[model samples]
Target: MTHEPSGLKIIDRFSISLVRCEKRPTSPFGCKVGLRSVIIHSVLLCSSFKKSRKYSDVGKLNKINFDSLKRPDYVRTLTIRCRHLSRKESNPAAGVFRDFRNLDRLEIDRCHLKSLPSALFSGLQNLYSLVVKNAKLSVIPLDLFAYTPNMMTLDLAGNELRIEPYALRSLRNLIHLDLSNNSIDFVTNTLISLTKLKVLTMDNNRLTNIDFRRLPKTLTDLSLRNNFITTIHYVSGSVRNLRRIDLSGNRLDFIAGSGSINMLPPSLRQIDLSNNQIAFIEDKSLAELKMLAVLNLKDNQLTELKVESLSGPENRLRLLLGRNPFKCHCGIRWLIHSTEKTYPVVLDLSELNCSSLLNDNQKLSLTVADQRNLLICQYDILCPTSCICCDKPVCSCRSSCPPKCRCYRSANMESAQKTRNVVMCEKMRFDGSEEIPDTITELQINSVQLEQWDIKKLQKLRALETIRISNTSITDDQANSLYSSRVLMELQLSSTNITKVPSNIGNLSQLILIDNPLTQLTNGDISVSEIFPQSLKLEKNQL
Candidate 1:
């Protein structure tokens, strides 16, 4: 017999019998057995031998299988990211662990992962960091991070994670956890279990409330901006190690509760609460913040502001109060007056102004000096005789004629004068007559009992520069004809019975007066330069 390359051989009956006899002691057949029994036994032995040989050949082929050849070696880091994977295709990360076993860090960004697989990080026992950013993941598996005991950082930014209780129960060793740009509405106990967490960013979420007591003690930075939080409470000095807190764009009206400000660690240097509904702030709420440097309160519903609220012994604060409705009245008059001198570098005085105190009769272009004088001298007339005695000489008075020469008598006489030009008249009344004085450059008819004015015939006064008809019963058309003088520089019709002003008033090339009772003024073809002359001056009676 000869061996073939395919390991097949054809042997004669004599040769088979000789081999069977040689191994008969170990076989079940004996030498006394006939040739028929020997041949059958020999054939059975050969068949068993062939089957064993076939199994040996298959064992060699199994050593070089295609699966083992494709398996990658253990590496220090592994990253699998598929950005263009559509929803119809299978998730590429499903079988990514077939090769990566000793991976220390894995980062997956912008992938089409609908849901996380169970034990995704099981084989990565040494994984120190895992990041999944911008993935369309709606849910996180319970045991996603069970095997990664040494995970130091876990980032799941830009996902739709519904943060519930015990959502992150196994990541106890996490140092940094970022769940920003998600739709997380609540923060539960599982998030608090990250005792080793140093930094956490949960910005731009839909969180309306938060239990500050469950915050980690080691947290240094926390961001909760762009949420529907109307108030921030339930924090009882638990976050002792917090350094920075960002609560901008929340709906906070004010900071309430005892120890709420004290809960902030001394290391806290910045707090942003811009674009909120804060109307008022107590002085004591910010007195404890010694280390606070930057405070933003930009857009709020503040009608009045007191700088003393933020003043302290060692004040290191930079405040922002722009875009707030600051009423420029007695409450904020001092601030408007001293803004240039006292807070030259502190407040943004350019953006601060009176919103509601000024009447429609008042000009919007009123300067700080103008506001100061207007506020000091109210609409009430101060009579010098009220503080004078007959025995003492009237130094401020020009002359004394008779008992009827008193200020009230003179004012009453002035009120009865129907002529448009009455310098001596304390109040002038118009009855629709054309008799207007030509020397009238300044007229004061404020709060008088005047009912009618024939302004169309009063055009004869070419020298009329200012006309004050505020707090009167003049109609809109009457006011328009009164201010149509080509030489009129200032006109005041505030708090009058008029509701609108003629657009042709802008055509008065030298007109500058705009103290009207109307809510809006439409601009005409005339430019502002032509309307307001260089000699424009608004008087108290005009406003």
Candidate 2:
């Protein structure tokens, strides 16, 4: 017997067992043994598994015939490569890989195949894994995997496949399936037949929404990152075994939840909702997510987070709350207290910042154990006289002649929709120095004296919507600027001295101008002809 450095070259008098080449073989290699029993028991894998080979320009072989090799059934693993050729010349004949009956693993790279026959993987009853990547395969036949029922892993990533439903129904025992980097748009009931599937990945697709109830119940890890998904729906007990779900880089505007009915599955342990457009989270949204351990809400549009919004299981949830425009108020002190306690620790606590309107619109850095007392509620400093303001739904002064304003316990404006605070100052006058709270939505000022009304302060109210300024003279400039508010919907200027309507009414749904001393609606270029409101009340105004 003699050995060479290039590869193993066995030369015996009775038989020739195998001839394996190292890298870039210049000639054909073969294996032949004297006895059939020796061929079945000895020569196992006689080819390079993952090596690159460049074909010579002389022979220019386009395909391989495993039948010509001695003891082809003894080969346990095989890797075929088609390099340096046009896409049209790289396709191999159908059933060319059927001779290796005992193959355990097979990989075909850069084959540029457009489709596969129904019986392409026939007779490979012992195959455990198969990988066909970087090919042009678009449509897979329904019965493609009928003969490979024992296959455990199937990876067809980097292909052009838009899989049809029941395309892989024959592989009941498939454990992991990676269909990433494809053009699949919808996957409704596409993978429900894989009863034993554990992990599934469909990243970088064109998926816009997903229903988890149609997925296989045995799946544990699911990743649908980098898609156009806007909403996800999953009922309880639908995906009972799912643990981790990654939905990063999507267009989700809010986490799906209501009072008690939410879209969270009970068995989820970790959820990644980072880099989305989530601006609101419903109260008790996470109450049913008892097994959750990690929650990521970074780089979103959240203005504030309520304590009830984060109330769910007793588990210490690890949070990621960085890069959000949080409003620095007393409502966010719960999060600061949680961070100070070090239970349910924020992973990116140092990267958090909040903007304060009372502090001259400055950005406040949020460090651990800092800014605990700096947060204040809207009514704590700007409450009106003879009116009690508390962070509850009902105030004690509501039984008086004038209705008292209610303060929302939550921080943000959208938190308490049903119980918004409405400040009422009837039959009173302000000294043009007292400021209204920014948290109030509706302001009712009746019979008040105001010759120096601040127009800038009215525009700075982020949540102000309805204004009822009665029995006060409204200057033309102030009236024009007030009508130009982007957020105001209803403006009641009843009994106020006004002559002309502002040209820039700006999408107001309702406009009231009753009992005003006006003869003709004209102010320079201001024309009331173009004004169109859904409901306009001009009963007592002079025309």
Report the lDDT tens digits of candidate 1 across residue range 449-500.
6566656555665656666565667676776776566666666555666655
Clashing pairs in 1: 414-425, 414-426, 415-427, 432-454, 491-513
lDDT of each: 0.54, 0.67
Candidate 1 whole-model C-alpha lDDT, 0 to 1: 0.54
On the 0 to 100 scale, the lDDT of residue 335 in model 1 is: 48
C-alpha displacement of 362 in model 1, angstroms? Answer: 9.1
Candidate 1, residue 158: Cα displacement in angstroms equals 1.9
Model 1 regions more than 4 Å off: 1-74, 89-102, 164-167, 256-267, 312-315, 327-356, 359-491, 494-543
Best by lDDT: 2
TM per candidate? 0.55, 0.64
Ten consecutive residues with minimal summed lDDT in candidate 1?
A: 26-35
Candidate closest to the true structure, highest TM-score: 2
As for candidate 2, its clashing pairs are: none
